[model samples]
Target: MGFTDDGDIAAYRRRRSVEFKHGRIAMLATMGFMTPEIIGHWPGYLSPSMGLKFADVPNGLAALNVVPSLGWTQIVIYFGLIEYSGGFEDYRSGTPGDYAWKALTSDDPEDKRRRLNVDLANGRLAMVAIMAILFQNGVAGTTGPEMWIPAL
Candidate 1:
């Protein structure tokens, strides 16, 4: 008797799946590991004295380190949950779509969506704030591992 049992729900889920997929791809292209150059440049922009020679580093670990530590912790946590807890199965089984449909069909869908968006925005803002604070507190330096890890 849930949302997934409805025909309209299936169509809605399909549309949402496509939309989420495209949006994820676009976001990854701009902000995720897909664009190592951008990631490398972020730390430098935040604190030039970090001495993170991202360009000279043997591998791309510099960029990777900064991203995972700075602001992508939510993504890491989400991925870890999906990975270790088999949440990916839910995704494959259309649970997220069903949930999305249910949310959209709810009596207060607009309010729910607004709250969710605000939460997301707040999380992003918090990440940026953390990165800025870390940089300001002189926590933005490259360890020697960046240079040697690549050779191994």
Candidate 2:
């Protein structure tokens, strides 16, 4: 059966709810604590305070490791690419919680797809930059993506 107007509305609502849930999950993940098991560890009133102590681990430790290995020229290029990719990842992941802050943030499915495409492109570029820098600095050999897959 074809979807009626009500069905479409319901689907839209469901999709929006999923997106908001993802946003919340991202926030919680970034917070470092509040995993289901840990939620009960803190007292009800002091949960926020307790969570703050356990949570708050910084993201992008891999990116941080890339820094010391890059040489002078590679450092500049790698860092620039990393920064760009990081921004793209944040956009695609929607973990920064800035969706409403942007003027043209769209809930359209097509727009979301476009954002994902950008995210993928940026991610690939970032990886390439990292590998090139690493290869130049003798951190990685010339085995290409295959070399990293096994390690992952």
Query: What are the runs in model 1 whose C-alpha is more than 4 Å off?
Result: 1-83, 86-107, 139-152
Q: Over the stretch 47-117, how does candidate 1's per-residue lDDT look in tens digits?
A: 34564444543222344556325446776788778658743232446433233545433447577656545
lDDT of each: 0.46, 0.43
C-alpha displacement of 93 in model 2, angstroms? 13
How many clashes does each candidate structure show, in the order listed? 0, 0
Candidate 2 clashing pairs, residues 3+ apart or interchain: none
* Worst lDDT 10-window in candidate 1: 38-47
lDDT string, candidate 2, 72-107, tens digits:
367589867965674433334443223442333447
Each candidate: RMSD: 14.5, 18.2
Q: Which residue pairs collide, candidate 1?
A: none
Instruction: Give candidate 2's error at residue 78 in angstroms.
Output: 22
Question: In terms of lDDT, which candidate is strongest?
Answer: 1
